[model samples]
Target: MRWEDIKRYQVIEALLLWEGKLNARQLMDYFETSRPTAQKYISEYKQLNPTGFEFVSQQRAHIANDDFTPQFIDLEFSSYHALFNTQGEHAVTSLVETLPQVHRNISPQLVRPILQAIRYQLRLDIGYISLSSPEFEDRIIQPHSLVFDGTRYHVRAFCEKNQDYRDFVLSRFSGEFAFEGEATFDEAHDTLWQTDVTLVVCPDHRLTELQKKVIAHDYQMTEQKLELKTRAALLKYLLQHLRLDIYQAAAEQQQIVIDPECRKLLAPYIN
Candidate 1:
């Protein structure tokens, strides 16, 4: 099928699944097309499965049938939200603006084995490189879960070489990983993954009253302070991602500080 026709079919399924009905006016307004064009699209879709919808003259719309089955799209909110972000067919402009990002280069080759290992409790023997070591080394690891720290994906796994749980960046795997065997370590044994740590943050004490207020407003803080909770194993990554790893920069540059007690508690794990 043509790309345009697939998009039209997906929108039709989205409306039917979410709103329980669809009308030509919804299509006309959404696609900015003529009445006959909207009707033609609906007619074309109905021809694929005549039992998918039933017309209601009172409502002037086609209500989805009790046995309606979508062929073009699944009922996932993320998929619907992605379609919604386009703001309808042929929309090119957006009301929102976001910072530019250079997408990471994580390949499906690395992701697939990690997912399979996590699912079946298997071990992986792979070559990995680390910034600290600067060379590829072969090791066995049992992946338990996957994590995305707002920037990139990390596999939370038990490293047989290190004898502990560690977060391995997906992009850092240097070569193909093969399933070694069943995993001997289990997720329940990873204490850090099971624990929660609270990070209390406050506007830098050195900032002026107005500056502190602005910082508080930016973070939606209550009384110039905010407390964030994260998994103990992820506390370091969370701090690094938020640029709160070190509270030693100039007050205006840093903007925030971790509570001294919280910093002390996290000291052993932050490195």
Candidate 2:
């Protein structure tokens, strides 16, 4: 098989292993592939997912054979150790906290389950508490991805009751899960837009040449000013990173002209 084919097969393997047994319809959506193509891969995957077996005939679905073992799993202990040190500055500290001395604070039990749900695209019914809202609320979410926010873990997912995509603080997901369901793949839910954020960076003339180099890449120098095009969601982050409040007429208006609904959705952050 070609490298691309091997990579595609790997995606299929990970999905099946993560989800346990995804139906043909779901598999088609997940892989963006035809039924025949997915079926061909599924036939091959059965031999691999040990527990995965074909349920052929009229009322057909994939089933786990007796020999099936959950080989597809979250990062193992060794894998966790290897990744811990290199993750970031807080990596060593977080690793240490996860040890027995601080076991309850960074609960390993909670960490593994949340990681598994993210890896497998599992739907989770969690009792979560927010700082703003002291009361714990029951939430049903289809976990889609993970984002590292420089510090703690954050899960990006589609919250069913909220009827929109939202980022949840992992630590706030404190209570026991009420229910966990196999995930149904979503295409539109995953196609996040590529956001473009523009900025005007006029490094003050008083600053030295090194200072100009420091702020150079994030901006473009004109005759006496700089214009920048960056991919970001919020203007605040751009302003903070550029470390300049310089403004220009064209730079202000050149922001992408997206749909009204999209603008409305982003207004709270962008404005």
> What's the distance in Å from true for residue 193, model 2?
5.7
Best by TM-score: 1
Q: How many residue pairs clash in each candidate?
A: 0, 1
lDDT by residue for model 1 (1-271), tens: 9999999999888878777899888788778889999999999999987899989999999999888889999977555556666673433213234456767667788688888999999999988888897888887999999998988889999999989998898888865777888999978999999988899899888999999999999998998889999988998888887788766658988998887888899887777
Instruction: Name every residue pair that clashes in candidate 1.
Output: none
Q: Please, what are the lDDT tens digits per residue for candidate 2 over residues 77-131?
A: 4433433333334422143333332222346665666667777768788777888
Total clashes in model 1, counting residue pairs 3 or more apart in sequence or in different chains: 0
TM-score versus the correct structure, for each prediction: 0.68, 0.41
Candidate 1, residue 211: how far the Cα is off, in Å: 2.0
Model 2 stretches astray by more than 4 angstroms? 1-105, 185-188, 191-214, 217-271
| lDDT of model number 1 | 0.85
Off by over 4 Å in 1: 1-92
> What TM-score, to 2 decimals, does candidate 1 have?
0.68
Candidate 1 residue-wise lDDT at 246: 69
